[model samples]
Target: MASLLSLRARPAPRRHRWTAALGVTALALAGNGLLAAPAAYADATASQAVDFPTHCVPPPIAGIPPIDGTTSAEITVDKAAPKVGDTVTVTYTVTKPAAGNPVDLALPADIMTPTGKVALGGAQTGSVTVTGPKKNPPVPGKGTFPPFSMTGTFTVTAPGSITLSPGDYNIHTSYIMELDTPCTVTNPPAPVSQTIIASPQPGANERAIQLGTASGKPGERATVTGTKFTPLADVTVVGRAGAAETADKMTVKASSTGTFTAQLTVNDKATTGIVAYEGTAWNADKGAGPAAYTVIDDTPAPPNGQKLNAAVAAGTLSMTQAGDTVQLTSVDFGKGGAATGDLHGVTVKDFRGGPAGWSLTGKVTDFTGPGGAKIGAGKLSWTPSCTTKAGSPSTCAAGSAGVVGSAGATLASTPNGALTGGEFTAGAKVSLDVPAFTAPGAYAGVLTLTLT
Candidate 1:
């Protein structure tokens, strides 16, 4: 029998070698003598160590595609030349590709000054609405862009003073669309420029006519001056008496500096009170000034018992009088009727022995009614129709009836040295202005006629 020897196995090596080329790790195992390492054990212990990358390189983000579009604008001014303090109208026309979605557009404007560009006080904005096919038929995931054209108008006031020089200026405006939408868009288009001309203020064209004296006696001369008229233009100065212009007129040529002076004499037979003097230059400019002249008794005092008789013609109208005093009683103003009545066939005879002429003056007091209600004295008026005059009575009524003043309006008068004991006949009409809401009561007033 073979001698059997028992042997204990030793521990394996603590460190192992890894071969990168063979992709295996080698381990050494200790055993008793005569034991050769098995090939299977050595193959199992040899294992390869594989290394992996710790950091990774990320991919890039996807880019957004740009939307192609175009923008254009045109500006026009209403006035070719603008003056200071003038309102300038700016008309703007814009054309742009409209996105299917609603978009806001900004219009930035500035005035091109001599120094530089100055921004406008208020900037404007416009809206573009994508409608019709662009809005109704959606292109799935893609946005709709449509072409559009629009117009807008605005106003700008020029400077009140001469701060801005008189020359050609440009109104510059940039049209831009807001890019806050979902799709990426291109930059806005170029700006638009419009030209305007500014002009200096013109001189005054108003002509002025002045009078030396506003009022003077008849046959008095008044100096008339005119300025700011057309140079070397013919200026006619005439006196207008009542409704008729006097034949006596003066025509003078304006000086080189547009100034003229002339003398206008009042007619000796001119009507008392207001007399209008008119000045006309170059048939385009005209001015008028009123002059009032008073006619008073400047002669010697007449003797006592100077009688003045006023009467109405028989068979025409009844006349009531108290010692050469004609009374107009019972003026009936009917309900809602005209405040007018006729005092038929009135006559006056002046027997005063005086060199100066005499006038019939009507004095009216307030119309007093019951309950202390009164109508104004100015509301009562009298119109004298002097139809017949003997001894050349200077009748106040020439073409129309003379309006009687409440205090002492001239009704009829005798010409100077013409009333040498003569009679003047006149037809009279009286009017009383009554309000619609007048109280229904008896109203009474006194109208006294005196010679002056």
Candidate 2:
């Protein structure tokens, strides 16, 4: 005769089911070895029980060990190791033996892993806190009861290591006794899952820093590499002209490295074409897929000259053999060039844009100097060549002065000595002398101001 059923009802047994039978001993698995259904069956039923209190009520009797009356929890989970989503917390303990009465702990909605589910108390129920038995007093028969604590919170979404394999899980709760009085149930047998893995520490696979061209001309330089690059920090590598965060910017930083290298010139006045090199694979996160590398130079530029500010206000560049009447200052052609100051004294201005063609003006002249020394009148306006060449050296074959046009001469003798001959009018200005041998130093030439 074998019987193990626990399913109380009235006075204090809203839910509790535990059935067990024993006597089969060898049915192996229905291959027919045990023939007629009993190899010494007196009464048997190994394991099969479920159904417990639907909601509230489960805390009384601490020690554990009660089948139907209620009180039998053996939940346990050390560290299943998580990764998929990762979140674990399970601790259980309920011994039994002190008195009896004071048990109420419930947890078992299928535990997890069939389809996987967890969200019991949010923030993971704080981490752990489900205790029972701060006080139990109701002595009567079979002793022991006064300790019940449980804590379970899991999250691992798809990815094994929890316990070892096969879904892996553990956590079963039950214990109840207050209200009408019945308490006497127990559980804790099939549970001890496993499976959680992640152990990396292998070897090599990372070496970058190679940019061939991403716009060049100004200073013209672009060549950086990477082999064993031990550079800790300071490898900026930024080349941007437009698109992706605004700010026409350019940066290049590299303090040190192994296969060693660092060159990203092109600032000699770079305004050529497609410019974008954002290869910042610096600290290493594996970033530098496709952001920079679009540099093209048709190469072929030089030979530019143009200056115009024609008379009306007053202008004169006389040196008819006697000598002395030059105080222009500067005006080189093509490729940007212009330098002349002082307005309101007559005028003296000149400039020329380069890369292809440039021009600017202002010239109100009147000088004397050959010993006569006069120079008066003012009005000079033309000094725009802060110089942003946009990448120079556009080649230069045969003649090579490549693009030549000149006009520069200085020496108005203003501090008070003599030759006030840096002449001007509308306002008053100065600067003269040059053109004798043409090479002494100041006389580059390129002035064409026709402001009628």
Candidate 3:
């Protein structure tokens, strides 16, 4: 008969402190022949010595009672058919009998491709949840095991760049349950599997046309480049100038890489501002949309000159304390470059004893200092009011203001010769061309007026 090797758990016996002493006393008595042998040892001779095994023995295994529980799991995916770079969510609901001890649950998943297996991103180790006592009544057909439910979620992502062939692939979900009583049950509920039908991704549908320069004049050359058209297709690019289609069109065959480049000549009579171009591919679905280039007039018309003037009357001048000299305040051309006032306080004295003709001439010195800044003499201009009276004190007549002329030009006397002092008043205006690079400061100059 064969010997059976059975493994079981048993308790250890207690040892007393007098056990070794008692064993030594018994052996001494037997050696001294004061003790008699029992029936079980009757076969042994008197000189025979008893022996015991000295090797160490291993501990027995512990046994635990079987847990009365059952487990089931169901899995669902968010999207059945997903495109490349799309996210697919996997949701699992697992049911286990509620027990006082803790239990562990695991959900392992694998993504299948046509070639091999692919990895998912989130929660590979799964989750665990503890359930309290049941509240509601159990269903009629279901067993009396009050069920505890646990839900776990994980994600599977499809890659963007690679294209997968159209086919049905299976996503398998595995479940495992373990109890704290050193026992595990693995009735994984048929490995809840779902099928995903993967289809070949569609091609990109984007088109664009670009110009080397956005703005150009008539007769200038502009480079045009078109992208994302159909490969190896005949592309017709047309340039339209302001409300006129079919003005300029060029046809070129696209390369194997779906791109083309060409040069367009701006029409000689192209209207100024935004010209458009469009590209169409022959027998293909992709083409460039309308793109614009700015067409500007190269030669613009010149601007007309502007005339500025200011008026001064006889009341604008003031007489000096000596009474022999009459002075007129200078017309100030400040940062604004213009000023206007009436000429006041002019003393009309008998110079030649009789009514004599007088002439007024204005000469302007060069504006100096403040780092040698200067304005042209011709920029200073004046228009003088004339009177026909030959008396000592004559007032200027209405509508006697003359046309403005440059102060550097000689002021002609009244009646084209000389004035008999009807109080000649002049209106002055200055037109300056201040260069952008000039230094900033106050510039002083002299203006000498002589009346003879």
Candidate 4:
């Protein structure tokens, strides 16, 4: 399903659904030995004094005058400190629109959804648009427009402090003249309305580096292996023969497993002793560390060239995910809302080749509304599946259908055995079932996935 760049509720056939405009509060990763309780967002609330120019869309009729006003917004965020890549909710409450002059108006209370953009600065740049839950009260002759609010969500892409300030906004009136007002911020607040610090994403990949041969002659070809490194990052490996001389520079990209192999000709002039291999990455936290190799004298080879060989170590078990967001496109009263697409697969690799078994489970927090109303977690469910990779056992089974809530529900399990040492991907079709009487608004929920 195609995702809307931003959702602003217009006159639609659906009557009771609130557009999902804001990010959910918190997300936790579960299971022992895994990073737990990593908050996905930072919580904050602030009121800023602001001034903007209102472009009151003129009506077709000659008698009615256009609407204009100066305004300020109170900004609120649910998470105070979030991890990078996590989505967070941002809300804005604006002071009432003071009319340009007095006039008679019949404003529709349910149809006109406010839309606008909030400027962002500091660690993250760009704006979050507000287009959501619609409500407007009718304005009697010379009467005041009440305070109005809008909500939207943005995913934090980097780690550091972010500053949010009020920006352009709009107000739509469904009166006889169809007057709409669009406001542009001329003088933004001195200090930003909301500032949240974001921490680094948890469970970053980094593991022991490997080399094809522990000892090899100078100017020879050798391979390097590694795991648990950042995925899809560019890596450069260098071989140094001595304190003053460099040997070779080989560059390659990390595989999905965060693994890479770079083969280079050892520097011909490299001192005949020990050589060091060092790796570096531009985008990841750390690169494969340095390793040592021996360079031998230029001895003549046997009838068949001497065999260049090395023993490999037992590998470690690891799990990886493709991405972080899940989307549920529409919600209804009885049928609720089903997620639009299949979750990106979470893969588990044993590589350990041992008898240890593993299990993956998931649970979700209740869905929360902007006004503090909630749709319970029990309303959500999923249909799960697991598929084995080339070397994986055909035995790991996907967990049964899950009614996700506060308690844990199994997602996939591998039984204890030697054959259990395989790789597989687990995924689900997540959904929500909202009650008819639930308040209409965009709701957010946290999903926690755990493995052991």
lDDT of each: 0.34, 0.25, 0.31, 0.55
Give residue 224's lDDT in candidate 2 (0 to 100).
49
Per-prediction TM-score to the true structure, in the order listed? 0.26, 0.21, 0.27, 0.54
Lowest lDDT block of 10, candidate 3? 16-25
Please name the candidate that would achieve the greatest lDDT relative to the true structure: 4
State the lDDT at 242 in candidate 1.
Answer: 37
Candidates ranked by lDDT, best first?
4, 1, 3, 2
Question: Which stretches in model 4 have alpha-carbon errors above 4 Å?
Answer: 1-47, 52-70, 82-89, 96-120, 125-144, 152-159, 174-191, 199-300, 303-341, 344-373, 392-400, 406-423, 440-452
Q: Residue-wise lDDT of candidate 1 within 133-191, one digit each (tens)? A: 10121222223322221111111122221111111111111123212322111222123
Model 3: per-residue Cα lDDT over 19-122, one tens digit each:
00011000100000111011010111111111111111111221323443433333344555544322233333333322222222222222100110111211
What TM-score does candidate 1 reach? 0.26
Model 2 residue 42 CA deviation (Å) reads 54
Per-model C-alpha RMSD: 46.3, 39.8, 47.4, 11.5
Which residues of candidate 2, in runs, are more than 4 Å off?
A: 1-80, 87-91, 96-142, 146-151, 156-238, 242-452
TM-score of 4: 0.54
What lDDT score is found at residue 70 in candidate 1? 34
lDDT of model number 4: 0.55
Candidate 1 residue pairs that clash: 25-46, 25-47, 98-146, 100-144
Of models 2 and 4, which has the larger TM-score?
Answer: 4
Question: Whose lDDT is higher: candidate 1's or candidate 2's?
Answer: 1
Model 4 C-alpha lDDT per residue in residues 250-292, reported as the tens digit of each score: 6778788777777756754442222222244221235433455
Model 3 quality (TM-score): 0.27
Better of 1 and 3 by TM-score: 3
Error of 4 at 52 (Å): 4.4
